[model samples]
Target: IVTVAGNVERPRNFEVRFGTPMRDVIVLAGAKPDTDRIIMGGPMMGYAMPGDEVPVVKATNCILVGSPTLFPPPPPEMPCIRCGECAKACPVDLQPFEMYWFSRAKIFGKAQEYHLFDCIECGCCAFVCPSRIPLVDYYRFAKSEIWAREQEKEAADTARERYEFRLAREEREKAEKAAKLAAKAAETKAKLAQQEAAKAAEGTAAPTPTAGDDAKKALIAAAMERAKQQAAAPLNTENLTPDQQAQIADAEARRAQALPAEGKE
Candidate 1:
């Protein structure tokens, strides 16, 4: 509902259709020929439109027609004299001047310390300001900047967590691969020891390649092949850092030492 008042002949409420030109709505209410500007909403909280030719949106609740006598330009802003009238006028009991000083300076953290969010943007502080400072606009700006900073912080935090997780997963995979290779080497060494002991007890200086001996050799060969493959890269090591290269080299060195001993035996 559009509350059509000021400079119109029949000032009353009208169910103005959405998307209709505000000028049409004013004409419907019988606007005076000398109407200077159109303001949406009440005098204190409302803003003046440059022209009434703009189409009205759902937010256009009150259409107050303005003339030179009705709505004169606000006086030049005077310096804050700290009269403290705005504090008394504030329904929320806020220090409007303090918040205004911090917000105007873009020191948003200081504005927050003054409980800036508690402001309902009702424009009461601006209405009573002896300095004629647009206090609510400053508070709104501070709130918007605070919101933007919070979003940036949240995004940065998320990116850091993802990077840390990737690094941890890579290190974990490398450790797992190294452990498997170590276990396999230990098992192969134990089997070789058992074979040597059995042959020494049988009094064979050199064991002939019997079918059973060939089967045992094949088993050892298969285990060694598996250990070699495990020591190979488990995943792509592309673009690895120097630290990663050092870790991979150490694992390969451990495997190399184990395999050489087994091969000599």
Candidate 2:
């Protein structure tokens, strides 16, 4: 639903598709030729749109057409005379002047301390300000800046966590590999020692192949097979589209071609 009113020849509501352009809506309402501004909401809270080319999304409910005569440019901002008009006009009983001062000075923490978020942005403060200080605008700027900084902080924290996790996983894999190598070396050394003892016991006997050597060879072969199996583990395919599954298959095929056969390097 889009409501095109104020400065249009015909002011009314219209049900249109979500992606309908703002210009089309304005045309339906007979927009004035000299429309100076096309705000996206009510007079008080609406933002003046850049142009009518923007599309109407789910949130677009109002389009306040403006002209020079209907909506004149605001007077140059004058210095605040420390009047209590804005505070008195505030419906939430908030000290608008204090928040305004802090916001203008870029002291957002101070503004928040003064209950800035409690402001309903009803435009009462700006409307009643004798100084004509666009106080609400300052409050909006402070809120947006704070929110943006918080988002950046969250992104930085997430990246740090991912990096830490990757490092831990790499370290764990390296430890496991080192432990396996140490065990294999210890087993081979023990087998060789046993073979030397047996040959010494039989003073003049020739040293032939032993079952221990064959066992050692089998252990190495098993380790290599386990490594290959771990490397070629199947990937999770749940919730993937047909195209995504096909892409994964193609990638795996390429990887298989790049890797050598199990027995070779």
Q: Each candidate: how many clashes? A: 0, 0
lDDT tens digits, residue span 42-136, model 1:
87777788888877888998999999889777788888888999999999999999998998899999999999999988899888887888888
Poorest stretch of ten by lDDT in candidate 1: 200-209
Please provide, for model 2 over 59-176, each residue's C-alpha lDDT reduced to its tens digit, 9 standing for 90 to 100: 8899999999998888989988888999899999999999999999989899999998888888999998878889889989989988888899999999999999999999999999
How high is the CA lDDT of each candidate model?
A: 0.90, 0.91
**In model 2, what is the error at residue 186, expressed in angstroms?**
1.2
CA RMSD per model (angstroms): 31.8, 37.2
For residue 37, give model 1's deviation from the true position in Å.
2.9
For residue 43, what is the lDDT in candidate 1?
Answer: 78
In model 1, residue pairs whose N, Cα or C atoms come closer than 3 Å (at least 3 residues apart or on different chains), thus clashing, are none
Best by lDDT: 2
TM, every model = 0.56, 0.74
